[model samples]
Target: MAAKQAERQLVEIFGHAPRDHSSAARTFWQLNACPFIGKECTKFDHTRTICYGTCSVTNAEQEVVICPNRLYENNYEAIRKVGSDVFGDIPFMLFNEYVRIVASGNHQMDCLVALGHNSGKEVKISQLSMDWVIAHIRNQQLVEYVGIEVQSIDITGNYRDAWYAARDMRDSIPASGHGLNWANVHKRLIPQIIRKSLVYSKSLLVKNGLHFIVPEPVYQRFEAIIGANIPLVDRPGKEVIVVHTYDIGPRVEQGRMRRLVLNRELMFDLNEFSKRFISGPNLPPGIALDDKIRSILAVS
Candidate 1:
């Protein structure tokens, strides 16, 4: 009944015949991206049908837009499988561009954008083929763990605290301050301050390391601290925030893939207002209740 209602709502919004696709078994990429994929269960072309589900039900243009849910429930995958002829690169574009396309053309799209700190970061990737990250997370025996860096337990003063922060207020929160400037900060905000500190303690395998795609503010502060120590490592001439392209690049890709799967991936990272705009609790317009009407009719 719930599914039927969702379908009905979709039909009303789209003003067209809804697709009726289903998954045989869940898949990882399909799972996260399921919310966006709807019914075609056949192809990725939004113009022809709704491409929603794990397994393809037909040869006409089997599109599993979302990844398989088999990995686990609630794990979103941003995958789109069109016909073999459509087997080229996926069209990832800006939000405005997608909107423009929608306005100008008679086509439809399931666009995705991923942005966040390390905690909320999403990954993007093709199925099965590891551009190269699978080995690190799974191989415990072949690799030996290496250096562990102790996180600075202290934080600087004038910490950021905006349960409801304006742009002006958030602007000054991330200014440059020296190491663990504890005296300037307060007890109430200490936990949050320390939690935001750069000092981290995570075990990594030799020839392997963790890459955290932190928020821009965190990135800036990190640059402030580590930027000075960068030149000594290898590229002796430059003073910079040194990040190994090989170490962190793959992880970023993974996070991108994850966002694509979740259907929540935005074409651009939202600002404060945009975030609020998208995350509001408001419901879609309600239909006049027909207590006797079955939900299948909604999609039909």
Candidate 2:
């Protein structure tokens, strides 16, 4: 017999599912809190009042991360992983905290400090912004830094009904035409990565290259869009861009979030990634477009 395919619906709300009835789950839902970032959920409804605390969702029986905050699980261990890989095994602190200590002349050098979206002032380069600017402090001076862009696939259609039903302790999640926005992976995300790579590649301070951190499935989709055979380095190197993919591991129990396991780290220079993007498999054929244009003209 064929196994039942999972319906596209809400799988996790504020890190756990609708079916979770534990006191901890209830408390998180009541408080509209996010365990990952250790604060109230950043996503909200249209009015910007109520928290829209959807974390992950079901797609083809697989739980996929939808919220970017969900990526901050395990105390931002993924960021730490990138720091260690690029700047060697060093301790990490929030960038703002580092600044405060530096002002007092008590800051330690040779440590990794991260300037994230919510961590005080943003560092912008020619109007482009990075999700996180990880810097290595040496001798109380800015030595080296890397730009990181973090993304979890966005969703199409509304899951508000399902979220409400889940929040109320419903037995079953309501169906709400929810689906993953896979198109955005190649359309917006990859292009943005390429553009940022170009900007960062020209800088002397950005020694480690720009990193794009995304969920495992999103990276798979990216490879499929652009031919998987494209040449890329397996280890971190002087490449202009690095792609880090992560998979969410199974939870030991309910009422707790899953662990994010680093799956793959692929590196590529600016020329390589941009070449793949321009001539990727997703691009339309020139002859086919010319024919469609002629047909439209003939109809007129």
Point to the candidate with the largest TM-score. Answer: 2
Question: Runs in model 2 with CA error above 4 Å?
Answer: 1-5, 290-300
Per-residue lDDT over 1-300 for candidate 2, one digit per residue giving the tens place of the 0 to 100 score: 999777677767777767788887888888889988889997787899888788887788677788888888878878777888887878788866787778988755678889886665567767677788888887878888888889999888888788778777777767757889998987898888888777777778877788888888878788887778777765554456788888778765666666878888777776877887888766789988998999989953
lDDT of 1: 0.23
Clashes of 1: 37
Q: What lDDT is reached at residue 210 by model 2? A: 87
Which residue ranges in model 1 land beyond 4 Å of their true spot? 1-205, 226-229, 232-300
Q: 30, model 2: CA deviation in Å?
A: 1.2
Estimate the TM-score of every prediction. 0.19, 0.89
Q: What is the C-alpha lDDT of each candidate?
A: 0.23, 0.79
- For each predicted model, how many residue pairs clash, with residues at least 3 apart or on different chains? 37, 0
lDDT of 1 at 58: 12
234, model 1: CA deviation in Å? 5.3
